[model samples]
Target: MTSTAPVPDPSPTATTPASAASRGARSLARLGVHVVGDGVDVVVLASQASAVDLVLLGEDGERRTGLLRARHGLWHAHVPDVSAGTRYGLRVHGEWNPAAGQLHNPDKLLLDPYARALTGEVSYVPEIFGHHVTDAAATHHGLEVRDDRDSAPFVPHGVVLPASDPVATAERLAARPRVPWSRTVIYEAHVRGFTLLHPDLPPELRGTYAGLAHPAVIEHLRRLGVTTIELLPIHAFATEHAIAARDLPNYWGYSTLSYFAPEPSYATRASRDAGAEAVVAEVRAMVDALHAAGIEVVLDVVYNHTCEGGLDGPLLSWRGLDNTGYYLHDGGTPARYADVTGTGNSLDFRRQRVVQLTLDSLRYWAGEIGVDGFRFDLAVTLGRKAGEFEPDHPFLVALASDPVLADVKLVAEPWDVGPSGWRTGEFAPPMHEWNDRYRDSVRRFWLADAKALAQGGHGTPHDLRDLATRLSGSADMFHRFDRGPTASINYVTAHDGFTLADLVTYDHKHNGANREDNRDGSDNNLSWNHGVEGRVESGSPGSELRPVRRRSIRNVLGTLLVSAGTPMLTAGDEFGRTQQGNNNAYCQDSPISWVDWERTGWQDDLLETARHLLELRHAHPVMRPTRFAYGRPRSNDPFIDLAWFGEDGAAVEGSAWHNPYRRVLQMRRAGGAAANPRSAEGVAAPVRRDLLVVVNGALNDVDVALAPSRTQGWELVWDSVWESPRERHESAVVDGAFPDAGTVVPVEPLSIRFYLSR
Candidate 1:
C-alpha cells in the first residue's frame, strides 16, 4: 500500500567526442524522430549495438545510410537538409549469437519504436525471420543461426512526422472531454468494428477512425449514455505469422509493433494513400470530433510485449535493436524469451530504457494525439519486477507520478499467465482494475443458476453471498487498500468473451470457424442456453424460450448497472449483437466481428432496455456509491447507508447468506442521507435519490415483504419483467405507495425491480 519512489530520469547526455556533443546540442530534448531547427534529429536507444545507422529511403527509391554517434546507451544524429515526410528505418549492427539473445542483422530493416507514423504493411515471409532458411530447422531445435536475406522489401518504415504546431496541439487538448472517473461509463469498442456496418456512414469512412466520429455513431453512444469509448488497440500492429498464413488477421490488435503510431488501416483509404502524416491527421480529427461530442477516448494499449514472438519470430523493431535490454530472456538460457504474456516475449520493465519507452509512448498519445486515458492489455506484466507482480513497482509508481499521465485514467487488466499474476484489487490506489470475479459471479447468478434449476438442481452452485458482495462494490477485494468502489470496473461481458446475447443463447462456444476445431476460448463460460442451444428462430415451437432468454439478458444488465462500481458495456451488447456463439472471435475480422446495424425486433427492445438501465444508473447515485456502504448510518443519522433483508421483511443474518435455496433478497439504500454525501475533499456533494433493489433468482414468482425503514413511501421505478420500453415506462409507477414496513411485493421469477423511496 506504500508508494514507491519515482524512477530517476536517465536523460541522454553528450560524451567527450565533438560529433556526439554537436549532435546532442542540436537535438531536441525529446525521444523519437523530431524536426529540430533546420534538420531532423533522430534519437534511438540502442544499448547493446556495436553500430547504429539511420537508413533513409527517398521518394525515388534511393536508399542512404548514415552512422549515428553513440553515447551512454543512446544513438543520436542530426541529418542535415532532411525534413518531415522522409521515410526512414534503423539498422543496428551487433552480434548474431542467438544463444546469448543477440539476433541483430544490419540487412533486416528495423522500425523506430517512437515512430509517430508508420507506412506500409509487414509482409510476413520467410525472409522476415532472423534465422537462415536452412537453419530454420535449427531454430525449431533451439539453435541460433543468421539469415543473410534482405528484409527491406517487406518491412514497414517509419515516416518522420511534420513538426507539431504547439498552438494547434494546445487547442486540441483544450477541447478534450475530461470526464470524471465517478461519472465514467466506459463502452469498450473497436475502432473498425464499431462503425463498420453503420448505414449512415459513407462507405469510404466505414471501419475507419473518421467513421467512429460520424454523427450517427456519436448519437448512438450518447443515447446509450457512454462517457468514454475504450478502443481496442489501434497502435500499428502486425498480423501474427500463423494467423496471416491462415488468411486471418489479428482482429483484436493485441500484437503491437509501433507504439507511437496509430494503425494506418484504421484510417480511410484516402488518408493511407496520401501517406503516414495524413493517417496521423485522420486519427487526430477523430479524437477532436469525439471530444466535440463530449466523449472521452481511451486506448487499449499493449505494452507488455511487442509483435515479435520468441527467438524463432521475425527480427522486427525491438528484437533486432537490443534483445537483451528490450525483452526479458530466460534466466537459464538468454536466447529464449520469458513468456509471461503468452505472447512469446515480455518487455523487460527491469530496464530503464524499456520503462522510458512505455512512459514516452503514453505521454505522446495523451499529449500529442489528445487521448484521455489508457486500458493496459495484460497490465500485470508491467508491474512485474524481478519475476513477481508488485503493487508499487517502479514503473507503476512512475506512471502514477508522471505529470502528464497522473491525471488521466489508468485501468489495468490485472492478470497474466505469469506466476501469481492474478492480482485483482491488489494494485495501488488510482489504478482501476477489470473485475473478472464480478463478471463470473453475476453470470452464475442469472444464467448458470437458471440452467441448474431447470436440470432439477436443488439450488445454485454457490450461495447468494458472493453475488451480494459483488453487487455492493467488491469490498473484500478493493477496500483493504483504501480503494473505493470506482476502483472496480464492473462488467458482465467484455470483448474477449461471449456477448450478452450469446451468454443466454449458447451454453458452449461455437469456435469451429477459428480453425482451432472448437478448442479455443474459455470452457468455463458460465453461460446457459435457457432450454435451447445456439440461436433460436422467432416463433419457433419453443416460443417460451425466447422470453426467458430476453429476461436473462435484462437480469445481467440490471445487476451490472445497479451494482456499486464503474460499469463498462461492450459496444455491440447494447443491441444484443452476437458472434454466433464464437466466444474468442479475436481472429474473425469479417462480418462476424462487425457490429451489424440491422436489428431484430428483440434486438431493438434489448437496446431500449439497456438505455433505460443506463439512465437509471445515472439518475440514482446510490447505485454508484463513491465509498463502500457498510450498512451503518453516520453518527446520529436515522438512515443506514445500505441494508439487506430477506423475503419476510426481516434483517438478513447468519446462514441466510449461505442459503442457496433462498433466491429472493431486498436491498435498500438511504436516499435522504445519501442526498448530500461527503466527498473525499470533505465537501458536501450533491444529493442522490435513495433506491431499493429487489432480486429474484428463483424459477417461480414469489411475494417479497419490503424491508422496514423510516422512508415515507416507495414507488416502483423500473422492472425487468416488461417486454417493451412503452410497457416498462407507461406502467412503471405503482398505483399505491408501500408503508415503511410490512408490505408484500409481487416479484417476478428471475428478474429485478427498482424502487425509488420518497
Candidate 2:
C-alpha cells in the first residue's frame, strides 16, 4: 500500500543559475528516493512539470499511485510502507511539445534519475518512445500528438537498495593499493572480454565479473605487473537501436543507461536471478578481490552523454523527466541537441544539477562500491560550457575541490567530436590525459617510419624531433600548467584500435565484419604489413618476415615502457593479441573481442619480454619521473637530470633534431636528479641509477657508441633483438659482457637497447 503523506518543509537553498534552462532546477538537494524518517522520502526533480505521481508495483504485480506535491520546482512525497527492493516508476505530467523542447509525457512511465538499482531492461519497442508510433500522420508530423500508450510494461523500474554500513565501506577504502602515479602501470581491459574464454573458469562463470576476479585472472594480471586495471564501462547500458536491430549488442558498454546501477549483463546468471542486490554484491566482490591482489580498479565513465541518442532519440531516464534541463540544446532550435560526444545528445555540465548528478554517482562508486578512480570518456564534453571547452569550468573546479575525489586519480580521454575538440593537454590539474601525440609518435618511429624507409621514402621532416620530445616528455603540450610528464597517459593501442599483432600484420583496417561496407574505422593506422597481409604461422610460407614483425613490436613496447610518462598497456598487447584486423570491433561480442588465452611459443616469449620491461621500469626511478625531467631543480645537483644524444654519443642540439632520416636517438638520465623528490626523511639524496636508452629506427643495423662513463663500463640491461627475455641466445648480461666507455656496439635494426652504467 502507498500513502501520500505530507512532506516536511525542507530547507530551501539556492545557487547561481548555471544555464538558462536551470531556472526550474533550483538546488534541489534531495532529488532521488531516499529512506528517511518514518518511511521513504521520494523527491523527484521535475521543476516544470504540472503534475507528478509515484507508482509502486507490488510483488504480486498490484499497483499503487500517489500524487507528489510540487514546491520550489521539486515534486515531493513521503510514502509509507516502502522498503528496500521496492520496484517503482514515475509519471511526470506536462505538455509534450517537441518544438518547444518540453518532452514530458504523462502517459509514459519514467525512470528515477538517481536510481541506485534498476529492476528490468528497457524494451526498445514503440511504446517506450515518447511520440505516437502507431498513428501514421501523427508520427510523420513529429510529435503532433504524444504517445498515450501506457509505457509501464516497456520501461524498467527504479529499485531501492538497502543503505550501506559505514564501517564496511571504510574497511574497503583502507584496503586500496593507492599506488603512486610515478610507480603505476595501467592495464586497460574489458570485464566481459578479459575472461570470457578463459579455459580454467567454469562455464557458468565465464564473461561475468566473478570470472574477472577468479584466481587465474588475478594471477595473470599480477604476473603482468599492472598496478591498476582500467576497466571499460560497467555502468548499466542499453545496446543502441542500430546495433540491436542487427541482433548484435554493444560490446564496448559505452552507451550507459544508469550511472549508479552496475551492468547486470556482466554478472553471473545466478547473481541476476538472485536480484539487483546480488549483481551489485558480485561487483563489490570483484573490487574487493582486485584490492586484495594490491591492484586498483578504475572505471571508464561516459558521463559526457547517455544511451539516449540524438534529438529524436528514445525517451529514457533523463529525456522524459526534463529534456532541456539535463541535455545541452541549441537556443535557436531549442528542440535540437548539441551533440558533442557523437553518441547523440551531450549532457549539460553547465547546469549545477547535472554536475551534482555526476559528482553523486562518483561518490557512490568510491564510497559504496569501493572503486579506486575513473577515466572520463569524451571528457572535453564535461568542460564544455556555452558550447566552448573551458579549462576552469565549474564542473572541473568542483572535481578538483571535492573532498571525496581529492586523492582519486582522474584521467580524461581529452577529446570529443565537437568543434576544436582535440584538447589533449588542456585538462585541469590532477586530471591525466590520454596523449595521442605520444601514441602517434611511437607508432611512427617503430612502424610507419620503418615502412617509409623500406619503401625508399624519408617521411615528414622533424619526425625525429617529435619522437625525441615524446621520448623524454611532451612538455610542449603539458608544461603550460606545470603538469608533469605523468599527466600524459601514453598508449599505442587501446580498445578501439588495432591490436599489437594487427599493427604489424595489417597496414589497413579490415572492419568488414561490422557490416559497414568496410567504410567504418579510421584509415590513418600508422601500421606496416611486413611483406604479407594476413596471419602467418611461425613456419608457414611467407612467415620469414615474422621475426621482423616481432622486432617492430619489441621496439614499440620498449619505447612505450622506457619513456617518461604513465604507460598504459592494452590488455593482450603484451603477448600480441589480435582482432583479425578488425580495428573497430565495437559490435563484435564473439572471439573477435575476447582475449585468446591459448598461447604460442613466440607469444610466451613476448610475455616474458613485457614482464622484464616492467621489472626494469619499476626498479629504476629514472625511467618514470613524477615531475618534468627538464625541471630546473631547486637543489644544487651536479648530475644532468636529462640529456639527449645522437648516434655519435654527442648532445643532440639545434636543427639536428629535425632530420627525418636520422633514425638513431639516445636518452640518458640520472635517478633522483630529474624531479629531485625528497627522501622520506626530507633529504634530497643522489639516486643510484645511470640509465641510457638507445633506439635504432632504421630498417638496417647500425653501430652506436657508448657515452663516456666516469666509474665503469655500460651494462647490457635489455635489448629488443632478444626473441626471449631470459634467453639472450647470443648476448650476455653485464660484467665485462658489456663494452667500456666510448666503445661502439652493433645495434640491431628496428630495436631499442637499455644500458646501465656498472
Candidate 3:
C-alpha cells in the first residue's frame, strides 16, 4: 500500500501512570489503563497467562516493572500519580503450550487492545515474534521454538488517554449529522488519500485527519452531495509482516492493532508528537468538523480479524494475552486457527470476552469519540458462530439493541473468505449490506455489454432481469425480510477494486509493482477498456475513444445515483481518480494509492457529472425510496409505481424481458408516498416524484419512444452523451421543452437518459 505521505514521523514515547504492586491483582474498572485522579487502575484479561507484568517506560529509557495480582481471569494493579501522557506495555508469562493454543511469551511486549492511541510502529522483525524467528530458525521450523529475546524495543507501547471531557464528547454526539439510511449518499474515502494532494489545503494539514476536515475538502464533499463519509479504517493498525518486510506500509489499514485507538500515523505531526491525547483529540475534532458541515462520519472498522494474522503469526496482543479466548480455533486442533477472513486468523465472536471487547470498543468510539457509525469489514465473520451465518447472531442482535448504535449507521461488507461466505442479504435490517450484485449488474450492463457487442456478441438473457432487480433495491434478494432498497448499499467501484477511472481504462489489473507477479488483484473485474488504455496516452488532444469512455462513466454514475438503493461513491471516483491500473495497490502507499486531486479537463467534467446526478437524486425522493413499491410491477396502469419498458415504449412483457439481444431498457418510476425512515423529526418527510430512465447498452443508436403516462410531460434531467455535465441534451430531448407521451427521443448508443415528470 502506498502511503498518503511518509507517515508523519513516529511519535515519541509519552509519559505514563505510576504503578504499585498489589500482590493479588484486583480491579474496580474493566480491562486497559484507566485514570483515577492522580493514580491509575490497570487491568488485563489474560485467562491463560500464568503471570502478568506491567512495564512502564520513562522518557530517558528507564523502565519500572511491577508484578500484577491475578484473579479468575483478570490481572490488575493500582498505580499512583497518573501521568498525563503515559507509555506502557504488558508482558504475560506462561508455559508455551502450542497444542492448547497457550502462547504466553513474557519476553514479548504486547499492546493493550483498548488503548486509545499507539506511540510507535510495530517493526517487522524476528525480535518482535513470540517464537524464534531468526534467520537460522527458518531451517529448523523456528515458529514452534519459543523465543527468549526481549521484544520491548521493536513493538509499540500503549499511551494512556489523558483526562477526557465528557461535555465535549456529548456535544459532538448531539450535533451528529444523523442522515437517515434512506437519504444517505455514502462517499467511501480514505482519511489520508482524500486530501493528501489537495492543492487548496495547507501543507501541514494534508494527509492527516485535519486535512480531511479542512474546509476545502468539506466543500468538495458538499458539492458532491454525499451525506456520509465512510472513511477507510482509522483504527490503530500495523503493517502486515510481509508488507513491512518489503518496506511498505499498510495503506488500507485493514490489519487493526487497537480497536479503541485512532491510528497515530494519520495525525498531524504536532499531534503525533503530543502523544495519544492529541491524536484522539485530532480525530474527535475531525468528526466534530464533519458533523458541523452536516456530513456524517462512518468508520470502516475491522472487528473480524487483527494484525496478529495466522497460526504461525506473531503474538502481538490478543494471541499472547488470551490466545484461545480471543481467536477461533479448529474444532479438533486447537493449535490451528479457522482462517475465515483470509487474514490468517479470525476473532471468535462466540467467546463472551471477545464480544465484550468489540462492544466496549464500539461504545468508546461512539460515546466518547463521537463517530456517526461503523462499516464492518468482513462482517460475515462476526456473524459466524457455529461455523455458519445466523442473522440472529449475538453480535448483530447486540448492535441492534445498543442505544448508542441503534440509529447510527451500521453497514456490513456481508461476506468473508470462508465457506458459504456470500451472504449478501443475510444481515438483519437496520444494517445496510454492500450490494455486490448491484455492482456486478451495473458493470455488466454498461461496461461488459459494451465490450461484448463491440466483439459482435451479446450479453446473457438474465442480464436485464438481474439489473432490473438491482435497480429496484434487489427485491428478489432482500424482500425476504422486507428490507427495502435502502438496505442495499449500492456501489459500482470501491477501494479494493479498480477505481471508476481504471474500470473504464484498463481491461485487466496491472499489479506488477506489488511484486506478486501481477496475480494479486481479482481477474474477474468485469471491466472494458474503451480501445484506449493507461491514462489516455498522455498529451493526446482528442482521443476518439475518450468521449465514449467518459459517457460510460456518466452512464454508470447515473445508474448509481438514480437507483432505488442508497449509493456509495468511492473517493476520487467523482472526478475519475485513477490508481494507474493497480487494482490491488494495497501495499503501494505511494501516489498510486492516494487520491490525485489535480484534475484534467475530462476529470473535471466527470466530477460535475457526478454532482449533477447527485443533485437530481437529492431533489427527488423517488430516486431514494425508503421502501420497495408495494404495487404490482408488471401492470401497465399509469398509477403503478414502477414499470418496465423497451425501445418501442411498450411494456417489456413476456419473452421480451428475456431477449438476449435486447440491449435497451426503459424504466418508468413514479415516486410515491411511503413512511420516511427519518424518525427524529416525528413526521415522515416528503418522498414523492416521478422519473423516467432510459438506458441504451446497444451498439447502435435507438429511437426510444417515451413511455406514456396519464398526468404529465417529461423534463430532461440528464443525458450521458454530453462532454460537459452542464451541456444541453442535444438529440435526447428538445431544448427548453418537455416531451409528452409517445414522443420519440433519439437516444445515443450505450448511454443513459433521466427524465422528470413531476
Candidate 4:
C-alpha cells in the first residue's frame, strides 16, 4: 500500500521491544538482516557476529542465500529485482533464550511483517508454542521451554507481491455505492453461513467467495432494502485450544491470524502459493458487484487481539517477529503482557511502530481490498493506552484523518472487558455506535411486560414514553454530540448474543451446545417464554405463548426499522430462523447458525411482514430521521409537535418515568422545516406534523385516543397487529378532539401502529 506520509522518522534508540531481538542476535555468528525496499544495495555489516547469511525462498521451496548489505548501524539490501510473488522467511543465527522473548533457534522460520499472502493455515505445535511444557498448567502462564523441532513444516509462509497503484484503486472504489449514515440499512451476516443453505446459489459456488457475488445474493439484499451488508470477521482465525481439543472450530472467525489475507478455507479452488491473493480479489469483486447494485460492505474486524494466545500462545507472525513490541508489555518489567483484550494479549499502541502497523493493515484492507467500512470488535481496547481509554487515541484519530478511510463507515462494538468498558455513546462524532439501550428497552416493552399488560388494569403510561425516546434516535444518548440520529445503530439482536428468533422462544441462554458448559453466553437476556420454553408443539393453540410470541416479534421488528437512526437486522430474522435454543453458537459452523431457507407457512407471513415494514420505512421520510428532532422547536404548536402522551392522550407528567405497566407510546414526528418545499407528500419541508406512531404493548385491548387533527385527515398507513397484505385499512378517520379522538381503536397486546395525516 502507498503511504501518504513520509517514512516514519528513522529511529536511533531501538528502544522498541524488537530491540532485544536485534541486540541478542547481533552477538551471535548466525544473525543476518536485509532490507528490501527504499535503501542501499546488498551490504552486510556485523560488529560482534562470527557469520551472517540472508535467506530468500521462492514458490518452489528453493532457498537463495546472499551476504546482507551493511547500512547505518544495520544490514541492508535493495532487492528491486525481487518483484512481487516471492515467498520468503527469515532465519536469525542467534541464541534461543525462552525467558528473554528472544527465541532465535534459527530452526524456526519467521514470517515477514509486510507479507501480503500466507501459503496455508498456521498449525500449532509444541515447538512453536512459547513454552517447553506438554503440561497444560505450566503453559498457561506463558513460561515454557523451547523445543528443537522445526516448526517451519507446519507454519504458513508469507508471500511477497509487486506493489500496485493503491491511489487509483481507492479513487474508483470510493465512487461506488456509499449510502449516507441515515439511509444505510445494515444486514449482519456470516459469509459462509449466509449462503451455505441458500438453495438458489449455484452448487459449486455455495458457501464460497463466489457465492456472495452471485446475482441471487444481490437480489435478496435488494428486496430487503439493505444499504450495507455487515459481514462477520473474515480475517484468517484459528480454532481455540479448548475447541480444537473438542474437535470444533471457532465459527465466528474472531481469532485473527493474517490481517491482510482472507481465509482460504472459504475459497473453492485453493493453491498454497497464490490462493490468498486470489481469494482477496474474489472478495473484492464481490464488493464491486454489491456496489453496482447500490450496496456497501462492512467488515467486522478483530484488532484487539491476534490469534496468538496468552504467554504460551503460538509464535505466529506477531510473536515470531517481535512479541514484546507487538503486544502491550508491562512498563516496569517489559516481559509481562498487559491482558486488556481478555483474549490473551492486547496490541500495544503505546509504540508508534505498533500503531503504524495497525493503521497500515486497516488501509491495506480498505484501499486494496475495497471494503466500504469496518465495525471494530471490542473497540474500547483500541482507544485504551497504558492506563486509560482516551477518545482521541492516535489510532482512531489517524483513521479519522486518513484520506482513504475518513469517508468510510466506522462502527464500534464500543465495549470490552476492561475497567469502565461500556462507552456506548462515547465515540467521537461521525462514528455510529451499536445501541444496547434500544435493544433492551424494546425487549422489555414488547415481550417481557406483555404478559402483565394482557391481564389488564395494572400497567402504567411511563413505560410507553421511555420506549418512544429510544424510538426517537436515542436522543438522550446522542443529545450531547452534534451527530444527529445517525449516531445510533439500532437493533434487537446482534451476532455476539442471541438471534431475534431465540429472543422470544427461550427465556434463557442454552449454550450447552457450545461446549463451554453453558458458561460462555449472557444470563440477563430479559426474554420471556410465553408458556412452554423453547419450541412448542406445532399448531397447538393450547399454549398462550403462540399469539404473544408472534405479536412480540412484529412489535420489536417494526420498532427497530421505523425508529430513528440506522437499523441493523441479523440475517435469518426475517424468516424466523432459530438456533434451536442455543444462544451462543460461535463454535458451531453447522446449521445451528445457518439460515434455514425453507420456512413454514406461518413463517412466510412473518417474512412478508418484515418486508412490508422495510418498504414502509423507504416510503416515508419521517421514519428515516435525516436530522435529530429536538422536542417542541415551535412555541405555537399546542402538542409540542412530538409530545409524550398518557393513555388518556394528555401530556405525561413527572410520575411517568417509573411507571412499569405504561404501555402506550404516542409520537407526533412533526415540526422542522422540510428541504423540498414542492414535494406533494409535504415531507420535503418539515411542517408541523407529518407522521404519528402509536404503539400499544398491553396484553388485553386498550383504547388509545389519537390526537384529533382539525386541519388534516388521519389515515392508517401500516399496522403490525394484523398479518401482511390485509394489514392496513384503506380510508382515513377524521376524529375530533382528545377523549374521543378516533373510533375506539383496539390495539392488541404487543402491537405497533403507524398513522399519517392526509
Local error of candidate 4 at residue 428 (angstroms)? 0.7
TM-score of 1: 0.94
For candidate 4, write residues 513-596 as lDDT tens digits.
Answer: 777778887887867777568877667754666666776787788889888988999998987888987877888998898888
Point out the higher-scoring one by lDDT: 2 or 3. Answer: 2
Tens-digit per-residue lDDT, 1-758, candidate 2: 11122332222221122321243233246567766544566677776666767777776873444444455556665666678888888877776777778888766788788888887887767777777775211223366557778888877788887777899999999998899999989999999998888999999999999999999999999988899999999999888766666667789999989989998889999998988889899999999999999999999999998887775556777888888889998786537888888777899998878998899999999888999999999999999989899999999999999998888789999999998999999997989999999999888778887887787775652358788788787898888677889999999999999999999999999988888888888898999997689788768898899999988889889999988899999999999999999999999998889999999998999999999999889888877876677533325455677777888888888888766778888787766443455778988755466788988887778888776664467778888988987755357743246677678887878889998876
| Candidate rank order under TM-score | 1, 2, 3, 4
Candidate 1 regions with alpha-carbon error over 4 angstroms? 1-20, 25-29, 134-143, 458-460, 635-637, 672-688, 729-740
Clashes of each: 2, 0, 14, 29
Ranking 1 against 3 by TM-score, winner: 1
Winner on lDDT between 1 and 2 is 1
- How accurate locally, in lDDT, is each candidate? 0.83, 0.82, 0.81, 0.69
Candidate 4 residue 158 Cα shift, in angstroms, is 1.3
> What TM-score number comes out for model 2?
0.93
Stronger candidate by TM-score (1 vs 2): 1
Once superposed on the true structure, which residue ranges of model 3 sit more than 4 Å away at CA? 1-29, 60-72, 136-140, 458-462, 538-542, 633-638, 673-688, 729-736
19-133 per-residue lDDT for model 1 (tens digits) = 5567676653466778867767778877777677777788676354444545667877666667888888987777777767767787788998999999888887767877765
Best by TM-score: 1
